[model samples]
Target: MKHDRPKISDVARLAGVSTATVSRALSAPERVSEETRAAVQQAVEATGYRLNLAARNLRHRRTGGIVALVPNLANPFFSQILSGIASVLGPAGYNLLIADTRTADAQTLLDYAEPSRADGLIILDGTLPATALQGRVPVVEACEWVPGLPAPRVKIDNRAAAGLAIGHLADLGHRRIGHVAGPRGNVLTEARLSGTAEALAARGLPFPEEHLYPGDFSLDSGREAARIWLDQPAATRPTALFLASDAMACGFIGEVQRHGLRVPGDLSVVGFDDIELVAHISPPLTTIRQPRTEIGRAAAERMLACLKGETREADTVLPVELILRASTGPAPA
Candidate 1:
């Protein structure tokens, strides 16, 4: 009842050729004689023989698979990104394997790069170290971490995105603006925070050192950040808050609500990453729209190129946009 998979040996026997000839004809057809190639092709169809990809790749020094590293797989924003990555790699005869690096230790990133298991890697976590990644495998950074390694990457201009947030608030007459930056050491967080400061300075607005709060790019951190912001004197309180993530913004909003305050009425808020629920929330978030799918697709394409040695080290940055919604309004008079 079980039909055995047709093998190269079967094809070689039917084609009246050696197994080496069959291998070369299938993998590197250019090396085989035209007559031998035709015979192998005909036998391949007659016997319904599919090349043993695993064996052939082993012989040819290839894994034929790729690994993706993610910081948090549960985040809805990453779902679209994963879809885009799959769309690109699936058709190219590559299987995607995900490594949730957060669950793994910091040093374990190297262990997952075994060339026998995965030909290359795409890392979404930016906090990883450069030395741990060197010469292990071809790697590409997508959206999050980049260690200035000789690898290709694709991301948004974090500083520019942050500037967009600041400008939006300043235009709405928010003179006392505060920022809830991402985790302390994250490059994205630092870039955005720097951009926020730069935008304020350009507009001649004050960038109070005390107004910046540290967060870990989570909802709970956002809520705690609001408490820190509230503890400041009323006069020094930021009339508007620019949070690094939508979840964070939501946390801030929730905390403010528990304190009997309303968004845009008592405290205006802007968030980064226009996540799925932002529009549906009571006060729709004003935020930056990151091209999540594009980030994934671009990273995949770049990784493929790296595997093929078609491209060297490079940085690819996607654009971002500001989405205005109810969460932000003219600063409270």
Candidate 2:
């Protein structure tokens, strides 16, 4: 005769918790006390209760969980990206797991690849090494990545995006243009830097190395970049700044104000990654509008195809638009 399946009551009895608590610990673990949750989990594992996971997860050749890995979840820009991923996955009856690796460190990135719990991975953070991916999971490179990876990707042309930012500044008659670059050795940094150089060269302009501010894609880095720009001699200082991200641009503007400088008066600014805050902040930001949600959706679709062994294009380049706002104007005469 076939064996009857173990019940929830059996798990509760072993765990010394109410059936309700067991359910809570299993489903919404954040609601349960750590100690009790651990006990319940131990009991569930001890009983070999797969708990419908085999059927629930696609990795088990069934409907499995899919993880959307982001470097930072709190950023408002990524919130829409996550929603886009969910929008694509929810209709297919797939569960979504969101994990913020917290840091861009290689070790943390590699840790996410282990065990292959998810059938596929949508990687928003580009810091992870390609070696870490190595067939462990179906990987779709989203907005960012380390340089020189052959993995399939979905993104806008970073080089052209940077050129657009510089061109906007140049059009404002800002001859001395400064770039607050992203983190050192970052893939975005190289692409944007190259684009800035190409734009300046095409305009018969020269970009001094001193005008490149080292930033790590943070508000603090932007603040630092502003301070460095201010330190330059007034006559020779960059009349305008183009930041690599909206966060950096906000920081730069905030810092400039703290020093009693007005945006678009003392300096004309252009930023990339047209996040929501760019529109609400004082003076509003002039920025490049990235198709962030579209990128997320495209990445998800690519990963799904890879999971299904369906042949698909290796790269998809989304388009970006330039938004001119109050933050930019003619350079101060």
Which residue pairs of candidate 1 clash? 126-145
Highest lDDT against the true fold, candidate:
1
All models: lDDT? 0.87, 0.83
- Cα error, residue 295 of model 2, in Å, equals 0.6
1-333: candidate 1 lDDT, tens digit per residue: 999888889999999999999988887687999999999999999999976677766776988888898889877778878888998988766788888877988557778777866888888888877777768888888888765666787999999999999989999999999899998778888888889889999999987788888898899999999898878888778989999999899999999888888889988899998889999998889999999999999999998788768976558989999999999888888
Where's the lowest-lDDT run of ten residues in candidate 1?
51-60
TM-score of each: 0.85, 0.80
Off by over 4 Å in 2: 1-63, 103-111, 114-116
Which candidate wins on TM-score?
1
- Cα RMSD to native, each candidate? 4.1, 10.2
lDDT of 2 at 261: 92
True-vs-predicted CA distance for residue 214, candidate 1, Å: 1.6
lDDT of 2 by residue, 1-333 (tens): 998687778889999999899877875587899999889989998876646555435434643667878877877778877878888876555677888877446676665666456677787877766787666767778888645556678888999999998888888888989899998777888889999999998987779999889998788999999999888899988999888989999999999999999988889999989898899999899999998889888878887788778766557899999998999999899
